[model samples]
Target: MNNTETPSFEEWVHYCFTQGYSDFHTEPDADHYEAHEQRRQRFVDIDPKALSEHIIRLFSNPAFLADEYTDQQIADAVWFIFGLATTYFLHLRSEVVPRNVQIRCIESVATLYTDLFDRLCDKHDVDPNKSSSKDTPLEDAVYMIWDMDCIEGAVMFPKHWPHLVDPGFRVLETILEKCRTVTCKESALHALGHIHMYHPERVEKIIDKFLASPDQPGVLREYALDAREGAVQ
Candidate 1:
């Protein structure tokens, strides 16, 4: 996210680290995504229970606790991850876990900071249950988590948060509202370049908002329009 010329595994892992999932660092790379069978093969090997349990321990462990991270940051990491782990484990798990011990473990961590995210969601009139809560569908909830208000507070303690970049275009395309403050505007602006396609009607309003807003840098504005207009011919 900070401006790297050539992307690499290390870079992607670092970006996702901010989002609090460094475990994905071990996932296969470009060679793995070259074909559908190759992609599906990766999923075939995972034992959701083992993977989920390992993830919980890694984030919870004090030593793996990023030295630069504040206790508050670490706490938020737990909260955000609890939600993600719940979503991925419960509904998305193709094979059900008999007991799902991971859910119980995640709930314990949720006690520390779910209240904070709930409050954040409240300010926006988004019901934690319906809008951005951990229980909400991940696709709809992403905007709430990556929101401008939440990002600074999260990344503040994680100076090395890099894993945050991998979800770029997919998240932006579905983000609820493109009308955002300067803080979030940059991310959406940057993500536009990576967009495959956007619904014409929905994107027009986003473009209008960008054009009307006074806060963006000139270059960002240029990219915004170019993104809407399809690569400047």
Candidate 2:
């Protein structure tokens, strides 16, 4: 592609996976994060809805279906999508558009994210309903997206606004109930706490249940307590 030409969604995805951005950024080396943000700006002009659709289409592509790409590469690409989509919706929220219009645009992109999540699970053979301690690439990708989109992305809705983001409250509730991983639960609780002022009753009820559950680990309960304290503070 020429320098002046806008990279197609597929091209950008390929660049993200094949280039340096997909590599894990060990802390103290913030270059990877900066690289990701810089590359993401390349397609800032593309409609988020369109970009999300391109991601969905990627699963069925001949190259993706063939044994050409490793699971790690695919996971890395999807990770990039989560960050990019988050940027898009956050931008939408900041726009001067009517509230309903902003919600509509966000909903469209959010729905695509939900679709993309399911496709990744099915195609990559990761079971979203089951929690495992395994650090396999596909599993990590699925859970990361779940945490990023459903948990973090959900709480980011404007204060006192109804939960309109796809993969929002309902999905997070499911993750809390079904996913046995403590780290995942901690992240979910932390996110809920972050939004607690806007969703006090719901957040408190869920965290209360988690704290009361005998099966939950002590560390998780402590995290929950800290989250509650943070919320009130």
All models: lDDT? Answer: 0.37, 0.51
TM-score of each: 0.30, 0.52
Residues 1-233, model 2: lDDT tens digits: 43434567667556656653334343325655665555545554445445445544553242443255566776665465455543544444443544555444434433333333333333434343433323466546554553454325545554534435433555556556765554355445656666566666777777887777788766667667776655422
Name the regions of candidate 2 deviating beyond 4 angstroms: 1-12, 20-44, 54-86, 91-154, 159-167, 231-233
Best by TM-score: 2
Question: How many residue pairs clash in model 2?
Answer: 0
lDDT of 2: 0.51
Task: Tell me the tens digit of each residue's lDDT in model 1 across 1-233.
Answer: 32322334333223233533333323545675354333222332334555445444543443434454443454344434434422333321234442344333333222212222222222344432232233323322322333323232222222332222222223343232432222233334443422324334444556667668575556557656775754521
- Clash list (residue pairs), candidate 2: none
> TM-score of predicted model 1?
0.30
Q: Could you give me the TM-score of model 2 versus the true structure?
A: 0.52
- The C-alpha stretches of model 1 lying farther than 4 A from their native spots are 1-184, 196-198
